[model samples]
Target chain A: MTRTSAIFRRELSGYFTTPLAYVFIVIFLVLAGVLAFFVGNFFDRGQADLQSFFVFHPWLYLVLIPALSMRLWAEERKSGTIELFLTLPIRLSEAVIGKFLAAWCFAGIALLLTFPFWITVNVLGDPDNGMILAGYLASWLMAGAVLAIGAAVSAGTKNQVIAFVVTAALVFVLAVAGTPTVLGLLQGWAPSSVIRAVAGASLFGHFTAITRGVVDLRDLVYFLSIMVAFLAANAIIIDLKKAD
Target chain B: MLEIRNLVKKFGPLTAVDDVSFSVPEGEVLGFLGPNGAGKSTTMKMITGFLAPTSGTAVICGHDIEAEPLAAKRRIGYLPEGAPAYPDMTAAEFLDFIAHIRGFHGIEARRRIAYIAELIHVGDVLHQPIETLSKGYRRRVGVAQALLHDPAVLILDEPTDGLDPNQKYEMRGIIRDLSPHKAIVISTHLLEEVEAVCSRAIIIAHGRVLADGTPAELAARSRYHNAVRLDLASDEAAGIAAELQKLPGVASVEAAADSGQATLWVFPQGGQPISDAIVRLARTQGWPVTGLYVERGHLDDVFRTITAPDATGNALRDAA
Candidate 1:
């Protein structure tokens, strides 16, 4: 536990030592506000809840989370710090989990900065604070899943560009998997059970379902499993390519 | 102590480290000598538990690297090739983080970092970003981090690769100062460094150990060992060459005149000492001698002869 925390503290502080964290947070806030008030039509909807504000989180995370995560392992490999890091007296699992937690916490910090939006809605009308709290949980969980996928993809290569592009593409497929158009395309060829599983397993499907003022245990499990499964793959990929 | 047993690493069909084995006890510094891609770094990686070996294990102190990696790693301090560190971190921050990883925290971590900084002479730049520091400072920071934990064993891969002459001298001084308490294995491209700091030298090529001995012992393997070179005031290249060739224990004598001055080389038969014999012959013949000395075999010659690409059949085998 102490070893994990040591890696965790170093990784977390590493984010703030560069401009990357600030740039990401600024972009996230600007895009979230623009999409919420301008494209999302928050006032026009006449709702006290932050439904419109929470609705665009999946779209926002699809682009931004990978940016935050591409450097998790790829930069370490390119700079050769991974050798010094892995040789320390720590387990591979601890390093993987510690890095993931750091990125996840960073995303959480950015999400917390969007608190003024919550206050805006509360001042505009009497909002259901419980539902808004659920929205925050759902948004943070979805971001965690995206960051986890990015972490695994970043470990496969030393090139951050490849990690960025591949992670964006993979998350894009997951975000649109449950849409009517995609399910319609899959109807003709894939088996019915497989198509149903794909639809149920879609990131957007689980994500959108939870942002509607309720957090389901199944949806929480889905997000946690994605994080766990991908983080496991991240550790395995690092161990596999350690020689390179 | 560090004991490696038949470590082998194979990437598909290509063998990178082929059954390499050696041991280093406390108070000994072993110099690992090899060319590029000679499996020197690869073997160090396996020993430090950074890369899993294809078919062997390293025992550090008493812990096996594969079975009890954390315990073994806790007892080891490794400076990987190029001395990689976080570019964004200040030297102090990196050391503090390393101290944390080594199970030191709070006051203890701070104390260790300060001590290491002073010992390695990095106290001046401890607060500067590692990227902004000079190459020598960066390399010293690497060594400092490896020494922060004060492990029982240290594995440094090319610790002084690009340092200036003074920095290289200081780096070797640091290695020698720490040699009495810990087992050290360092690999370098500079052969002279073997004589400078290493108590024992291991020459490896083609992923195998070609020779292992003290610096002098490896130098003795050269054909020039115990040979004598004589300088004559006379420019006659032929007369002295024939006369010196007949001396007992003298294998052959060759004389050459360069710019009107004659130089004679007497190679001893079967690695015998022939300087005394040549001195007596010079006195009896009344040859006008200016300078003469016995040649301790050149390490470069021994290195070249052993690792030559077209070596004879038996020379290709591991001599260690």
Candidate 2:
């Protein structure tokens, strides 16, 4: 565990030493702001809630999370330093968890910097602060889920570009598979319960339920399970690569 | 102490290492000699527990490399083939990371890092990012990293692969200084490097151990009994070859046409000194012997003789 912390500190500092963390924060905040205020029509909707902002998060993360995680393991393998890291006394699972936590924390910071939106809603009207807090929690957890998936894909290869493309495609499919538009198209062929189950499995479905000021244990469990599944797969891939 | 027994590594259908076995006793430097693509790096990786061998075992400090990897790795320090280091971290930071993981703390870790930095002569570049340093300096950092935790065995693969001549010499001196306390294996193609630091040399080819002995012994094992090349100014080179062959212990003679030099392959027949016999023959013939020196055989000749196209080339060359 001490070795894990050492690797975690090094990886976290590495993010700040380069322009990656800064660039990711700026892009995330700007894109979130633009999508919320301009396209989502925060004022035109005249809503006292953050429904407009939360609606666009799935699409935003589908593109942004892969960009943030594409280099995590790919760059290490490309530079031939993965062997050094793996040969250390630390277990592979600890290293994977430490690196994932670093990226997740960096992403959390970017998400938190959107606090101005909370303040803006307060200034304009009386929005439900409780629901807003819930939205932030959901967003943070969803970001972790996306980051974990991206990290697992990243560990599969040495090419960052391919990692980004594959992870983006994967997250995009998972994000939209159970959306209303896709479910509506399948309504005629599938039963309502089947459609509901499919939509229930989508990232947006679970996140939307949480952002509505409801802390569902099932929703939290779902995201946590997905995060663990992907991270475990990542550990397996790293072990296989070392074996090779 | 380390022992590699019947080590074999295969990638699909291609065998990288083939039935290799050797043992490194405590406090002995074994120079691993081979040409490129000779599976030296692969062998080192297996011994360090980084790669698993297909069907063999390596015991390091009484720990099986495959079964007890962490324990085996704790006892071994490895400098990989190209000496790779994380380019983003400073030397001090990298060493600190290694120290922290090796379970050193606070003042102890600091003292160890300082000692290694000064030992490898990389103190000047301690604060700089590893990628910013010169190649020789980076090589020193690689060596420093291997020396950080003070492991019992050190496996250095081409330790001086990319250093300049002066740096190579200095690095050799550092290795020699460390040789008395640690069991070290320095893998390289440079014969002189073996002569400079290691007392024993193992010549490997096609992923198999070809020959193993002390440098002098290996060289002497391939030496012909008084076979000497003479560069003498003589109008009749063939006549000299014929006359020298008639002397005791002179089994055969071969003459080169271009240099007018002849090599007499002697057999130490009847316990006669081949040099005294050649000297008496040369004085009688009035052949001005320009150069006459006993050949101190080299590793190059042994390597070529063992790995050449025909195994009998060495025997035939010795006979004539």
Candidate 3:
């Protein structure tokens, strides 16, 4: 465990030592802020809630989370640093978990930086801080799920571009799979149960439940399960893929 | 101390290492000699517990690599080939990370980092990113990282691969200094490197141990042991060659003429001493012999003769 923490510190330091962490925070804040004001119509909606802001999270994470995670394992493998990590006395699982946690924490920090919006809502109107907290929790969990998937894809190949593309595509499908916009277009072609199942699997549905202060255990379980499943797959792929 | 018993590694149908076994007594230096692709790196990897072998076992300082990898790894320092490292991190940061994982804390880690930097002569570039350092410095950092934990068994794969002559000499001196209390195995294709640093040499060709003995012992086994070289004056060259070739036990002789001087490379058969026969034959013919010396066959010849027949010889040799 101490070794894992050591690795975590170094991994986080790696993120910050480069321009990556700052670039990510700036881009994430700018994009989230712009969408909240414009497409989300926070002012026009005239609601005390941050429903306008939380609503765009599923779509925002589909692209951005993959970009954040595409370099995790793929870059390590490409640069031959995986050999150094694997040769250490630490267990493979420990290293994987440590690195995953570092990426998650970095993503979470970016998410936390958005709290000024929460403070702004509270200052201007009587917003439900409890619901806003729930929304933040749900959105963070969704990001974790996306990160896991992206990491797994990144482990499958040495090319970060390919990992990013595949992760974006996977997250996009998961986000829109349960949405009415897509179901309405294919309403007559597919059964309602199939549509509902697909829509229910969407990240939006799970996060929406949490945003409404409805902390369904099933939604939480689904997100946790996806994160574990992808990470497990990532480990398996890294073990199987021989270095060139 | 390290012991490997019949260690074998296979990748599907390709056997990278086979039935390789040897033991390194504490404080002994062993040279791992093989051609490119000869399982030197694979054997090192298995010893470090980076790869599991298909058969046999590697016991590092009494700990089995497979069963107790952490314990075994903790006692063994491995310098992998090509010196792989995180490009984004400075040498100091990489060393610090390694020190942290090796259980060095705070002030102790700082002291150890400084010690390693000075030892490997990378102190000047500690703050430079590893990618920005020159190849020689990068390799030094790799060696520094391997030695940071001060393990008992040091497995250095091509430790002097990219070093300049001066750096190579310095590295050789360091290896010699470290050999008194630590067991060291140096894997390299350069025969002179083995001659310079290793007390004993293990030659592997085609994934199998071809020869194992002291450098002098192996050199003495060459078929050219009885051969001699003689330099002759131009007027006496033809007479010497003709006479030497006809002498009893003299099977084949090669003579070359250059710049008014003649040189003869003589091969005497039947285990006969070339000098004894040549002295007798030269005196009889009254040929002036400017120089006469026994010509010891080079280690390179022995290596090429043993490893060239099977290119696969380069891929499956193991050193304990």
Query: Compared to the true structure, candidate 1 yields what TM-score?
Result: 0.98
What's the DockQ for every one of the candidates? 0.91, 0.62, 0.66
Cα lDDT tens digits, model 1, A39-105, are: 9898999988888898899999888998888999999999999999999999999999999999999
What's the lDDT for candidate 3? 0.86
Q: What tens-digit string does per-residue lDDT give for candidate 3 at A149-217? A: 998999888999999999999988888777778888869998988887787787878888898988889
Q: What ranking emerges by lDDT with the best candidate at the front?
A: 1, 3, 2
Residue pairs clashing, model 2: none
Question: Which candidate has the highest TM-score of all?
Answer: 1
Specify the highest-lDDT model's number: 1
lDDT of 3 by residue, B36-131 (tens): 888888888888887778899999889999899899989988888888888889999999999989999899999999998988899999999999
Worst 10 residues of 2 chain B by lDDT: B263-272
What digit string (tens of lDDT, one per residue) describes model 2 on residues B45-107? 888877779999999889998888888888888887778788988999999988988888899
Highest DockQ among the candidates is held by which one?
1
lDDT measured at residue A243 in model 3 versus the true structure, 0 to 100: 54
Candidate 1 lDDT over residue span B184-255, tens digit each = 999997988999999999988888888899999988877789988788887665788888888889898877
- Report the Cα lDDT for residue A181, model 3: 88
